[model samples]
Target: MNSNHPPTPRTLPTAAAADVPTFGCVVYISTLPDGRKKGRVANLDGIEHTAGTEREVLQRIVPVFKKRVSECLAAGDSVPWIDPILEIDPQEQKRFLPVHL
Candidate 1:
């Protein structure tokens, strides 16, 4: 085979992929009518939580996301979402998908 081209990247099994801990969920923030910022953190399983302020929402939702994941696992529910993290594997690209600032 010719060596001019780069090698094809290999795919790792979902389990085998190296996980790098990072923000796992997408938090949607908006200015409320009263000017307070509101946020909704959502995961792949359709689990979501709402809170006021970016700091507070993240603090609250991350734990809740973990709890939800645990519950989903305990019940033998297929984890619908990737574990919350930045996922450092070169195979994985980009943290959370685009979210409006």
Candidate 2:
């Protein structure tokens, strides 16, 4: 190895790299009775966050959802992923969020 040259970066094996998982879930946003926006994960029961706006609700929920996924993976439990296609009421809005650890 030449002292003036930088070392080449090594790539991880495909399978090994894939082991570090990426999680995704569907968040459904709906207006509450009092007009606040509520963001609820489609597959995680009781996992919800509320804020004054759609953007704020999403910002609040993503971290909480990521933490839950991290905890599950740390404990060797399966993450609760949302379905590819979820049926929702017409009044609700939805978005798919990917959680990368």
TM-score of each: 0.47, 0.68
Expressed as tens digits, the lDDT of each residue in 1-101 for candidate 2 is 79998999999776644556677768899998999998888866557889999899989888888888888888999876655545677889888887777
TM-score of 2: 0.68
How far residue 43's Cα lies from its native spot in candidate 2, in Å, is 2.3
Model 2 CA deviation exceeding 4 Å by range = 1-20, 82-86
Candidate 1 lDDT over 1-101, as tens digits, reads 56998889898776755643343466555556765555554445444434566566556656766666666667989657645622243322222433211
Alpha-carbon lDDT, every model: 0.53, 0.81
True-vs-predicted CA distance for residue 29, candidate 1, Å: 1.3
Model 2: colliding residue pairs: none
Please estimate how well model 2 matches the true structure, expressed as its whole-model Cα lDDT. Answer: 0.81
Q: Per-prediction RMSD in angstroms?
A: 13.5, 5.4
After the best TM-score superposition of candidate 2, give how far the Cα of residue 84 lies from its true spot, in angstroms: 7.8
